[model samples]
Target: MAREQFDLIVFDWDGTLMDSTAHITRSIQAACQDLGLPVPADQAASYVIGLGLREALQMAAPTLDPADYPRLIERYRFHYFLKDQATELFAGVREMLQALRDDGYLLAVATGKSRVGLNRALDQTSLTSLFDGTRCADETFSKPHPAMLHELTRELGQGLARTVMIGDTTHDLQMARNAGTAAIGVTYGAHAASSLEALQPEFVAQNVAELSAWLREHA
Candidate 1:
């Protein structure tokens, strides 16, 4: 497909646009430690990508008492917000987005993160204006639900066939499939290359550089 053929390109936050895996894992581990629970390692934390915080927390610390979930979530959020000011956008992300935008692709974000969390990241990275629209977990059904993608397509006044979803997890790929749009998975974020490939994205890029190339060819 020509780069300008797609009317909209939806993005997943966290591991997709930013390198927040270590920051997120460290914050969650600290929260678990404070609650006297075992801290999941980096690889384990990566496995929780694309799910809402509540679900990801449960998966990360399944041994924790169910009643303590709220407290754990609060602690994790507090620690994460405190340290996330230092979060950085992934290499080549800004240039890639600019390239796509200059090529006339409408950009949007569909993330499992809450609005506050997503806004904070965008502000920190000076990317608040890059997106034409955002659909967050707090405002819509979380992935792998297709609500956000569907909403974005409607909001953009574009059909699903003319849109694409780019993300780093199976949840994102599945969401795209569920919404009947093309999906591209990237491997430099939270999930492994083989794992994302198993979801059968239309294309899988090993890193941001390759992802930009793929977008150029398929967008």
Candidate 2:
């Protein structure tokens, strides 16, 4: 049987669309310092990609008292949002998104960022208008859960079989699988190529140019 073409494309925000790992790591470290918790460095931060702030805080500061999770999340969000609002879009992202939008493909974001955080980044990068819709951590369940993708498709009045998820993490791939949508993993993000490949996405692209070409062929 032939594969169904995708009408909608859902994106993962941080590591996939934006090159804000350095800023994120620094913010996480600062948050930890403020909370008097152990700070995770760059490599450690990568492991937290695709996770909500509450989850990332647990991984980055495992020894913290369980009762402090909420406070930790608040502090992390406060620091990261203030600094990362100025984050840059990944190379070719704006052009690729414009092309997709111009082509009449539905574009949306399904990210681990809070709604406020996603809005801030989108506004800062001038990408707020590019997306037709968005589902953030604060708005839906975090990745590896499929709730965000499912909700996005429903909101767009699209079918899961006709949607594609574009992300850089296994969490995104797994979410796609759970939601019965196709997935494309990007290499130029937080997760390594091999790591993303391990999830067996329907496609994998090394960069935005490559991703755009693949989408042109597939979508």
Candidate 3:
């Protein structure tokens, strides 16, 4: 804790900072149901939480023809936004991000959400200015690919060695690895703790409180 190991801390959106995992899972399932495709189970649906909508749908409704993806995506968006107001950031997330920023660390987001979708969430939460930069799946390659992280670091003028990625899914962790950066996983989101642990993150926090504490002392 003597020296800050990271200059930039990038976070995944849906499950990491926001409490939208269940909502996303429900939307995916509902979309499949609307398309008469097999509805994915909660875990199955949640597993795709950190990928691009098209990639997620490809996994969640694999039986459906590729041409029908637009239909599924439309339905999924309908369901997700129906209760969008109900989705809130996990407790203490704002404070944690503010504290990090106040301490002079550059904060950014690398999310699976589309540019439009991410903009909506950030605007609704009034967190637009807190981020120094952001990269969405629609604007770059999806998770587990290095493009998003690479772009963010390059934009921020931060090196891979000076950046850390945080999230609640294996895709997030994998993306960090692919980008040659450190990762911290949170268990209170889409993926299970065991799954995140298998990715070998620097830390696994159970909640925002725990995550904040770890970052305070170690980031």
TM-score of each: 0.93, 0.91, 0.98
On TM-score, the candidate that comes out on top is 3
Each model's lDDT? 0.87, 0.84, 0.95
Tens digits of lDDT, candidate 3, 87-142: 99999999999898888899999999999999999999999999999999998899
Cα lDDT tens digits, model 2, 84-189, are 6477888888898998888888899998888877877887888888898899887767778989988889888999889999998888888999989999999877
Residue pairs with clashing backbones, model 3: none
Cα TM-score of candidate 2: 0.91
* Candidate 3 Cα misplacement greater than 4 A, ranges: 1-3
Runs with alpha carbons beyond 4 Å of true place in candidate 2 = 1-4
Query: Any idea how many clashes model 3 has?
Result: 0
Superposed on all Cα atoms, the candidates' RMSDs to the truth, in angstroms, are 1.7, 2.5, 1.0
lDDT of 3 at 47: 98
Candidate 2 displacement at residue 40 in angstroms: 2.5
